[model samples]
Target: MSETNSQQNINTAVTLLERYAEGKRNFSEANLGNADLQGVDLKGSDFSYADLNEANLNGANLRGCDLSFANLSQANLQDADLRGALLFSADLRQADLKGAKLEKADCDRSTHFPQDFDPAQVGLQIKDG
Candidate 1:
C-alpha cells in the first residue's frame, strides 16, 4: 500500500482507539505501517492481522494483547511489555526487541526472533521452527 493510504489508516485507527468507551478495541486488518505508537496503553487490545511493519512501539504496554497474524517486520518494540500476549503466525523479521519483555508470549515456528537475542538470556523457549 502507498504511504499516504497507510498513514490515513493509522489515523483512523488512533481515532477509533481514542473514542473507544468500553471493551477491547478491535484494530484487526488495519494498515498502520510506519506509525509511531510509543508508550500507548494498548493492553488487552486486539491487533490481529494489522500491518504494523516498521512501526514504533517503544515502551508500549501490550500485556495480554492479541497480535496474531500481524506484520511487524522491522518494527521497533524496545522495552515493550508483551507478557501473556498472543503472537501466533506473526512476522517479526528484523524487528528490534531490545530490552523487551516476552514472558509467556505464544509464538509458533513462523514467528521470527531477533538475531541478536540469545533465547536463554530472554527466557524464551524456542519451539519447532
Candidate 2:
C-alpha cells in the first residue's frame, strides 16, 4: 500500500477505536487494514466496504453485523461469533475462521473464501436474492 493509504488506514483505526470506546458501534466503510482489534465487542455494527485485511479480530463478537463487500483477507477470526452477519461479497481469502460461529451468516457467489475452504462446513449460508 502507498504511504498515504497507510496513513489513512491508521487514522481510520484510531477513529474506530475511539468511537468504540465512546459507545459508538456503527463503523460502516471503515479502513482498518492490519489493525489489532482482537476480542472487541462490535456486535450489530455496520462494516460494509471496510478494509480489514490482516486485522486481528480473534474472539470478537460480530453477530448480526453488516460486513458485505468488506475486505477481510488474512484476518484472524478464530472463535469469533458471527451469527447472522451479512458477509455477501466479502473477501475472506486466507482468513483464519477456526472455531468461528457463522450460523445463519449470509454470503453469495461473489464472496471470496480461502483456497479449499468450505463455507458449508462452517455453517455459512448463501444469501438468496
Candidate 3:
C-alpha cells in the first residue's frame, strides 16, 4: 500500500475508536482493512457489511456483535471474545482464531472459516445456506 493509503487506514482506526468511546456502535460498511484494533471492547456493536480484511482485532470483545456479510479474510482474531456474535456470510478464510471464544456464535453456510476449523467444534450455531 502507498504511504497515503496506509495513513488513511490509521486515521480510520483512530476515528473508529473515538466513535466507539463516544457510545457509537453502528459501524456497518466500514473500511477497516489492515487497521490495528487490538484489545478493544466493543460488545454488541454493529459491524455488518464492513470490510475488515487483514485487520488486526486480537483480543477484542465482539460478543453479540452483528458481523453479517463482513470480510474478515486474513484478519488476526486471536483470543477475541465472539460469543453470541452473528457472522452470516462473513469471510474468515485464513484468519487466525487461536484461543478465540466462539461459543454460542451463529454462522450461515456462506461463512468461510479457516482450514480445518470446525464451527460445530466450537459450539457455533450453524445455519443452512
Model 2: how far residue 55 lies from native, Å: 0.3
Which ten-residue region of model 3 has the weakest summed lDDT?
2-11
Give the 10-residue window scoring lowest on summed lDDT in candidate 1. Answer: 4-13
- Among all candidates shown, the one with the greatest TM-score: 3
Runs with alpha carbons beyond 4 Å of true place in candidate 3? 1-11
Poorest 10 consecutive residues by lDDT, candidate 2: 3-12
Arranged by TM-score with the best first, the candidates are 3, 2, 1
lDDT (C-alpha, whole model) for all candidates? 0.77, 0.85, 0.89
CA lDDT of 44 in candidate 1?
Answer: 85
How do the residues 1-129 of candidate 2 rate in per-residue lDDT, one tens digit apiece?
Answer: 553343244335566767677776666667788988788888888888888999999999999999999999999999999999999999999899988899989999999998998999888899766
* TM-score of every candidate relative to the true structure: 0.79, 0.85, 0.89
Q: TM-score of predicted model 1? A: 0.79
lDDT of 1 by residue, 4-112 (tens): 4432353443653563444536767778788788988788877888888998999988898888899989999999998888888888888899888988877877676
Model 1 has an lDDT value of 0.77
- In candidate 3 the C-alpha lDDT for residue 126 amounts to 93
Off by over 4 Å in 2: 1-14
Tens-digit per-residue lDDT, 4-115, candidate 3: 3332332378888887888878888779999898998989988888889999999999999999999999999999999999999999999999999999999999999999
